[model samples]
Target: MYDEMSQLKNLLELIEEPSDINLDPEEKKAAQVERLFNMLFEEHEEHAKIVADQLNKSVEEIRSLPYSEFRKVANDLGVADSLLFKIPRLNRPRTFMSPKDKISSKLFEGVLPPGTNKAEIAMENKKSTKELSAFVSVDFDMLPNIHSSQEITAYDREVHDAIVSLYVDGENEYITNQMVYRTMTGDPTAKLTDKNRTEIDNSIRKCSMTRISIESSPQEAAVYGMQTMKYEGNLLYTKVVTGVQSGHINEWIYIMEQPILYRYATSKGQLSRTDINLLNTPVNKNAETLMLQGYLLRRIEAMKHPKYNKSYNILYDTIFKHLKIEAATSGALRKKHSKLRDTIKKILDDWIEKGFIVGYKNNSDKGKSKSLSIIIK
Candidate 1:
């Protein structure tokens, strides 16, 4: 059997850090080309075919062009050029363009000049002023095997996702407080309301302490790139978000630095190797974010015990309250029993449509009625 840890590490380093200082210029150039090709392979699958058709060159021949040689051709070709410049600099999240090879070194190695912080140094040194990218590559393989049942309120998940969106965007360092408030509460343009700010503070504190278990062996999971990212493992590295206007509300945001692995985020933003966003998006009649969350929580509860597995049917009311829905919204949202029941039933219908759950035996009210069951693939 192959050793996954060492192989994945080597594969990432060779492909990720192509411009490593240790490599000679020729070797560095070759590595850079390979990494660029890999990025193209992931994002722009048709690049090879496009170039091949235009130049009347075989895909293999076009691929054979080294970094230096391809630059000239890419400039002339434009977006379909598939060159380093054609892709957004944001795409080159991991590869630091600073004088220092790594983003960490750039921030940490030098003595700070007077008034600057890490976020300030990052803005001056990094590729983008608005977004901060993760230093480590995003690993997707072991993410699916994580079995976590600890329920969290939808608000916390949103807060987590907003921060995670930053992480996935490669803003793994100091995220702006405004970014969090905007992304989490779904009021992107406006400043954080005092009520929302308190919600943020509470959620972050909870996120720091919460830990989901890895059902598999720790060593095995780590070797497979799960990164030992238990919430309780290392507290989120939070700092005052720098780079804000003096009049604006400034607060802290967090990221897990190097050596600490990031766990899978619950948000739909986390993409897999094939570019699939695995998070389940439930449809709500209201179409609002909060309403959509209610559907999601209901669906999750439904998964825990389908009537097919056990004798008892999972009650809509049981799931409704389990989701921690506030009483105020419940009265307004759940006014008509049939209406709310139909809406919740639509969740089961959608699951069945997606083949996530099954209607193995729906004998109607008089006959043998069973809950909609989960279909385990």
Candidate 2:
């Protein structure tokens, strides 16, 4: 039931690293469990008694159970199976990209400068400067296209999507420009040329500079095990290192998933994985499609039904929020809302044609009940 004491200590050390490593509440609990077991293995009867009480068994019975059986007993006591089996060593395939539910739902919805009116004014002024110089000096021609804080767009979210593959925890992660290129382009065979490499670098810089703040309800905070309901931080922090002698460059990107966001990632149920290749394709590249898809991806996963038989009921106002639609008057808002309904129909029709979904029904009644009922395939 116990491994070598030295091995157990090493595992605890790895989990409790003093760096900027962010462990969700469950991980901290897992660490506590390891500490308890280590004490029990050393014949600590009090710790054994605690587990025995929880499981309604004798201290000897609790100690006699194998580690696997102990996990099952703890699972029966409401410990998550993922924490017991998958967290210490995640075994996810490389094909799927796991973006946090909060990020997916809010990141593209006018949060990161795109879809906001301020972005339009900034684009017209065109005062973009070179911000990547802090990371690494490059040729004038090699600079990213939009370097200013206000120039973030839907395209930048693509970079965020790609980089999320590196965001397992709060610790800084290393990646090369080539890996970003492959992930963003969704083709492992895609070449890393000068133009696209500059684009990737620019996007990274843009993401690092953009700030985001999320305010969650008490219910939401409790659901994700967050101690607080409010969070404010930048989405990313990036440092680039160039090997002058080897002419190679690598990026150390720190994904700052705050307590709420980190809990969303660790909860497993609060995250959604999209096929990288299909998501980056030209068909889903537009802002509306991207925003709607992001919202749908997160919402669809929460549906309590099997696939091909499930449907989603989305409100017109909900679509307006996700798509960031704004209007000056009720009449104009209604017009734009009507137009957006058509736009959504066309987008859903395209999805149906591509066989991504089966069909949808419009339940708009020209009243407060305007909504869309979409059938999932």
Which lDDT tens digits does candidate 2 get at residues 1-377?
A: 33456433433333333221245545644554555455434543555466678778986676557666765554454432222221122222255354545444344444433421222111111243521110101112222344543544555565676666545421225455666656655556666777666567666766665554555444445545865454455556554321111111122233335323344355536455655544434332333555555455445445533632444787878767756677899899888777666656765675567665677777857655477777775
TM-score (all chains, Cα) for each model? 0.35, 0.42
Reference-based lDDT, each prediction: 0.39, 0.50
| Steric collisions counted per model | 5, 0
Residue 267 displacement in candidate 2 (angstroms): 4.8
Give candidate 1's whole-model lDDT.
0.39
Candidate 1 error regions (>4 Å): 1-154, 170-172, 176-178, 181-192, 209-232, 242-246, 258-261, 264-315, 325-377
Residue-pair clash count for candidate 1: 5
The candidate that wins on lDDT is: 2
**Tens-digit lDDT track for model 1 on 87-164?**
111211221111112222221222222121112222223343443222222111222122222223445445554565
lDDT of 1 at 61: 70
CA RMSD per model (angstroms) = 20.9, 19.7
Residue 227's lDDT in candidate 2? 50
